[model samples]
Target: MSFFSRRKLSEQELNNYQQQLNEFKYKITKFEDRLDKLQNDLECKSQGEPLQGVNVINAEEAANRVEKAAQKALPHELKEAFDEINSAVENEQQSVRLFQYELGAYVCANGKPQRKRIYHIDALSKKLKKYGYETKLDSNGPNSFLEVSWKGKETSDISKIDPAKKYVLPLEDTECEITDSATGKAISYEVAYACPRDDKWRIIYDRKICSDAVIVPGKEIIDVPKWVRSIEPIEVDY
Candidate 1:
């Protein structure tokens, strides 16, 4: 072919290009069809129509499923602690309860004044230590308590926690930033712990973020309780 002249494509080359173009067009059409179906399904859902080929669940059933999922996600020790706390609160008896605060964990005894009993501080400390946590027993003070914190440097990163395999039991009103697995965006959530008053722990993400986004804790220690305050009566109500 001359420098300024275009060379004629061979029949084989033309057929190959046409095949490729047809493939591209086919893919685009399929993609558009999928988009249309998704939009139509969403509209039908908004209009309270049953989605075709989809298993629709009632509100109560959906709520039950979510509750079950949340229960499955909770840590075993945390669940046990919550049950014990609930029982103690219900019976209005003296018992030691574990509270997971933003900075650390606190084990506090609830009930009438007991000058002699240490409230199973040693046993609780050992239990916490088994989970790679360092426990400090504070019995010398007026109110005997135990503080639990991450044991080593490796425990500082909350992102290392696998949500599918494990869950962190943070106290109510605790705040943390998490990364959305779907959008790869950072989202902040105010955590509420589950107790007798509340059946499930909840993460209320910021209004600006999509509530449906799957999120995991950001790279920071979320379990460590940084400050200590005067121990007061444990209120399970509300």
Candidate 2:
């Protein structure tokens, strides 16, 4: 004799299976929504329009916008000499960081020659012209910088310098002592150098006591010999 029997799923089992199916459906819906958005973005790009609810700008357009903003920010007297400006903008985010142009000039104060930064746009413009040079905005990889040209020939570039790579010397010739919160040991360290790799201060101490070097945060390092925090950093060959 042959016999066959079928067992039905319990209520709990049925509910679990239903929930899994609903989760799968939800995931499919999300994927479809994403695909639709990508298609719309492609269409907008093909039509030379920005994506909806997203900021986008080309390099040339960004440069013009930055120039306009700089012009407005400049004093009225400097407006005429403001020929062009260079800057970088994140294409997708439309974020910009413009370089603040400076004219390295020297001034005499109290019979001492002191270096002065001339940020006046007009003065910079006039100086550039007097030197038979002109500046144009140019792209350098993903960023932008001013390309200096003399008589229509490219001479040099003015680009943003990494702050951590800048050379610095302590205002006072002394070592700083601080208790290491991590090791609970008193340590003496001197500002050895600025590490360009991670944009942090490299502190050096006796290798016998601690590691050869340790990286310190800017906030902590700035407390020692405060003058190292100058905007116009002193340049030295590492």
**Least lDDT summed over 10 consecutive residues: which range in candidate 2?**
85-94
Candidate 2 Cα errors over 4 Å, as ranges = 1-5, 51-238
Count of clashing residue pairs in every prediction: 4, 0
> Candidate 2, clashing residue pairs?
none
lDDT of 2 at 211: 24
Q: lDDT of each structure? A: 0.38, 0.35
Model 1 global lDDT (CA atoms, 0 to 1): 0.38
How far residue 25's Cα lies from its native spot in candidate 1, in Å, is 1.0
Error of 2 at 34 (Å): 0.4
Question: Counting only residues 3 or more apart in sequence or on different chains, how many pairs clash (N, Cα, C under 3 Å) in candidate 2?
Answer: 0
Model 1 TM-score (2 dp): 0.21
Please, what are the lDDT tens digits per residue for candidate 2 over residues 6-108? 2465887467545554553354334434433454555678798867675554546554644543333233212112222111111221122222222344444
Best model per lDDT: 1
